[model samples]
Target: MHLLKIHGSGDARLDDYQRPEAGPNDVIVKMKNCGICGSDLTYIKIGGIPTPGTITALGHEGSGEIMEVGSAVDGINVGDRVIVNPMQTPSNIGSGGPEGAFTEELLVREARLGMSILPIPAGIPYEIAAMCEPLAVAMHGVNRAELKAGDKAVVFGCGPIGLGMVLWLVDRGIDVVALDLAAERRERALALGAQAALDPTQIDLRAELAKLHGEVPSYGRVGVGTDAFIDAAGAPNILSEVVAIAKYHSRMVITAAHMKPIEFPAGRMLTSEMTITTAMGYPTEMPDVIAAMPRLQDKIASMISHRLPLSQVLDGLKIAATPESCKVMINIDEE
Candidate 1:
């Protein structure tokens, strides 16, 4: 079978791999559309992800059809459209596993399967179904924030995750502001329903928030500081900005992992009484993320700025890093 493998550090190409066995406990999918996650770019350029592993199949966010289902995998049948959740660790004693997410024909654990399956309601499309994973990721951040209706939310970063966060927050009737350095992203965020979008590099976030809410007549609402601040930006200092804009008792959720050690101000956190939580991608939130798809609309699929055949995988990765592109989708099933 043809699969996408990293040709070398900073590259990717089609490689013939042994076919996956259709075992009773296993499920096999014919690749369809897969998004090039930022993590995939890191692995290709940096040789691999933070963890060590020889380049194997690469691609995590994808939607496809069930060509065959193992006998043990009941309720699943051929022609059943599905999306594979690429992240998981097989349950076992002292099991420790973490690695890459890029692949064509994905084999996922039955228990770790996500909301990628069909039965997509009246308006949902297969491309959108492929997006449940990232939406679920943003949902994890929102879930951690403990957001409520009418609350204000600021999502930092206009990357796919950040945009998804904004869409989710807005769908819940919460007023939101999306912050990013890219003007295009800021525009996209607003289009996704953020009441306002600002380029933090050009606008003072503190001042902008105060302007929108007017004077906080009373300080004890506990809802101050945006009810919740989501740092979708991977930059470390951006996390501090999330903390800075948070009201007393408001929570700050870090959705992206930092590549460096960021200096955090101990004094402000202690004085403001703000709570902080970091969201790690896991199997826990996939269902709710998938269930919320109807509200996300086409904003999820619209994020796909470019689509290329799998033979051009490396070129696709490069496009994802550019400011002009949003989400780059790789047509892995294509020659």
Candidate 2:
């Protein structure tokens, strides 16, 4: 088998790997599709994951067919299509594990149903099924926001995860205003059912939010009535800017991985009584995300802006690093 791995700074290459064997309690999946995430670029730029490891495999958002099932495993069989939950795996497969989905096959040790893997509905395409991982991350962010129907949200970023936030929010009947500097991303957000998509640089975001979500009056001051805000943009000033203008009692969820220390205006935030939280890997959101995939297939499909075969994953990573693309998928089964 062949897989992509990072050796050192700015060094990611395809190398031969031994084919995995399924133990009595393990399974081997034939990888079909995997999406290149922004973090993959970061890893390549700075060598492997920060953890103490000489080499690290790359790829997490993926889906595949059960090529080999464990003799002891139940409810999962060969030929069953499934999406992996990397976090549930013993070694966090892909990020810095012994196995990565960017390979011909992946070994799932101690595989179990609805935990290490979940069934992909028959109709969902493998490329879209590959998105389940990131969508689950987005769903975790949405769950953190504690949003309700008829509420309003402003998603700060129209990248894959941010766009996923838009889709999930819209499906829950929330009015969403997605912000991105890229016109293409903004347009994509609108296509995913956000009530409005605006470039924050091109508009008065607070004023626009006020008009779209109505205005909230609190302690002789007015703020946008949006009930929640999601920071998927990772901009240095996004947190401060949101804290400066967030409505009273509203919520903010930070899903973006900011590399640098950001300024958090505690004084400004205190006045609003707003709650701020952070979401990382999905805890219990993958099941719901998978269940929603069938109904949201069309919307999810629009998020994919580019596709490349596994052999061209390096180029795919370059494309994903640019603003022109969203959800660059590696068709592992191709070429």
Candidate 3:
């Protein structure tokens, strides 16, 4: 079998690897499609995600069919289609480590198979099912924010995750103000049902929020009061900027893992009594996300800009980094 291996910075190659036999309580899946996450590019260029220099096998967000099941495995058969959750341990298949879904086949432990190896809903396409991982992440962020009906929010990015945020928010009856630096992304956000999509670089963010939601008078200062401020963009100055326009007693969920230390003035947060929290990895949110796949199928489909086979994995990475693309998927099943 051929697998994608990341050796060093800006270095990746397809290497021949031996197939593995499922243990007594394991499941082996034939790879179908895996999306190239933003972090995947980061791992290829730099090194390490959870730990430094840990990228061995690449590609995590994927879906496949069960080609084999161990003797001890029950309730799962050889023909079951499954979506592999990469957040599991790397020692097993679909693990969110160096050993991921970039290969032709994967070995996953049955003990960790509950939410980790979700059976793809019948009739859902492999490419759509492959998106469950990222969509799950987006759903988890919304779950963390605890948004209420009719509440308004400003999403700080319009990438895949940010766009996913919009879809979830809109489906829940929340009005969203999608903010991004790129015009194309802003347009995409608007098309995704964002009440307003503004490029922060060109507009006054605070003033625009004021227009969407009425002004809030706090301690002789006036600003817009929004229900939540979700930052999906890992930009350097976004934290401080969001703090400036945040509503009093509002919730600010940091979905993006900012690589650098960002300065946040405690004075600003204290005055507003705002709750600033962060969300990591989706837990127990895959089911709801999968159910909504049919409703969001079209929008989710638009997020994918390019779909290439494993042989062109490196090229897919390059397109993902460009401004022209939103999401890139690698077809591992294509031989």
lDDT of each: 0.69, 0.89, 0.81
Error of 1 at 137 (Å): 0.3
Any residue pairs clashing in model 3, and if so which?
Answer: none
**Using Cα atoms with residue i matched to residue i, what is each candidate's TM-score against the true structure?**
0.87, 0.97, 0.94
Worst 10 residues of 1 by lDDT: 91-100
Worst 10-residue lDDT window, candidate 3: 89-98
lDDT of 2 by residue, 226-287 (tens): 89999998999889888878889999999998989999899887668999999998899988
Error of 1 at 315 (Å): 1.5
Which candidate number has the best lDDT? 2
Candidate 1, residues 81-155, lDDT tens digits: the string is 666665542521011122123345655545223333433445676567767777778888888889899888788
Task: Quote the lDDT for 136 in model 2.
Answer: 88
Candidate 1 overall Cα lDDT vs. reference? 0.69
Which regions of candidate 2 deviate over 4 angstroms?
A: none
- Give the alpha carbon lDDT tens digit for every residue of 1-113 in model 3: 87776776787777887866778887888889999887777777775444555556777788899898888777778888898876664454323343568888877765246
TM-score: which candidate is best? 2
lDDT of 2 at 195: 96
Candidate 1: stretches off by over 4 Å = 49-53, 88-104, 109-123, 215-225
Task: For model 2, state the Cα shift of residue 305 in Å.
Answer: 0.8
Would you list the rank order by lDDT, best first?
2, 3, 1
Worst 10 residues of 2 by lDDT: 45-54
